[model samples]
Target: MQAMQQQRQSAAPGALAAFARFVLCGGGVGVASSFAVAGLSSWMPWALANALITVVSTLLATELHARFTFGAGGRATWRQHGQSAGSAAAAYGVTCVAMFALQRFVEAPGAVVEQVVYLSASALAGVARFAVLRLVVFARNRSEGAATARPVCVPEGHVLTPAGAAGFCRAA
Candidate 1:
């Protein structure tokens, strides 16, 4: 039981640390973007304003996640950016739907109400986004962590290899 606990702790240490960094980096940008979206909404339709802010903030957050949150050790690649963008689009939809529901229930909802709804939606989406980013977008970061031990793929016909290890071999 102790050994199992230790292994679980070792595996989760990176995830817990990464989640803290993710909250700091992504939450900061989200707060800023919320204000920006609210401000921009005054000049244009709220949806348009939200779309603009979402794009810019998504870019900034992806960069921050790569450098600080996920410990990618460098700038995010185009592929990572694209994948992050996909997840952000879903988050955007979530926020928009929440806002729409607010509008439906309350006639001319006050700024405070709108912000409350928007931020609530954002928080919900953020959790899922963190999962997707950690498990898929920035998976390499976890695999590269020193605390984690990854199985090595042995070459075919290596003397040290067990018969069960054949599953790791590439199909010729």
Candidate 2:
């Protein structure tokens, strides 16, 4: 029971770390996408502007997310980037479609109503994006060779246990 408790305690930090990374990356992407849509919509059709902004922002976000969020430091390949972009695009498309349908029927009398609709749609889309990103784009698979690779260590203290020796081996 003590061992199990210790194990759970050890795992808690990892889970928190991952969640922190996700929040940071998600916030960055959200800001980028929001700014892009608002800025571009002034010069172009709202739909086109939204799509363009989403794609560009998604690509940039994916790179940051893969490196910072998923601990996939050295594995940010074009394929992985593409996969993230695809997931973001799908999420964006769904949001746009829903927003359009709602706006068409919901007859907003004032600017506030329109704003609420757009904001709500964007929030829903963000939820979808995170789900796809966590589950599909950056799926955690123990069998994946990358996950099994030993982490590099920074010099700290004298090696004592077998685990310490393995860490030293990795560092060396």
Candidate 3:
């Protein structure tokens, strides 16, 4: 059916937009967190500083993805916060395991190599984070009652139809 095809087609653009936002926002968080960690490391153990920066940045990144990337309400509810926490925990576990494997087997002999390995692990974990955020954490539940409708954000100049979403330009 044409309607079914259109419906299927409509979601991809929004998903792509969300993915773009996720990558940009996540990269920004990573860069800022790294700088914070670098500064903090001079005053404390590297591990301690890294953990401190990561924790804050992870929470902020979750909120950004939920609000800006997925157009979920900017206000984070308890449920949303919990979901973000869960996603971050899962992502952290994956990242740690990947980094451990790389360190155990690879010839990462210098600071640069170690940083590259870390970044690669983080990037891989980020893919998982995006999946969880889209499918579970910030998903739009269509079955909710009218009274439970979420305050979705629609940027100016984008069209949101029943079959489509908040961050796309409609073709004339």
Root-mean-square deviation per candidate: 8.6, 8.2, 10.4
lDDT (Cα, 0-100) at 8 in candidate 1: 51
TM-score of each: 0.76, 0.66, 0.65
Preferred candidate (TM-score higher): 2 or 3? 2
Count of residue pairs whose backbone atoms collide, per candidate: 0, 0, 0
- Candidate 1 vs. true structure, TM-score: 0.76
Residue range 41-71, candidate 2, lDDT tens digits: 7899878988887777777777776766665
**Candidate 1 lDDT, tens digit per residue, 1-172?**
4954654543423788899999999999999999999999999999999999999999999999987787776789999999999999999999999999999999999889888899999999999999999999988655666546555567766654456554565444
Instruction: Give Cα-based local distance difference scores for all models.
Output: 0.87, 0.66, 0.69
Q: Can you rank all candidates by lDDT, best first?
A: 1, 3, 2
In angstroms, the error of model 2 at 40 is: 1.2
lDDT of 3 by residue, 1-172 (tens): 5854644443322788889999999978876765676578689976667667767987788778756777664555678778777877766666567556766888655556656766776788788888887888766531232345446666777677856662343343
- Pick out the ten consecutive residues of candidate 1 with the lowest summed lDDT: 4-13
| Candidate with best lDDT | 1
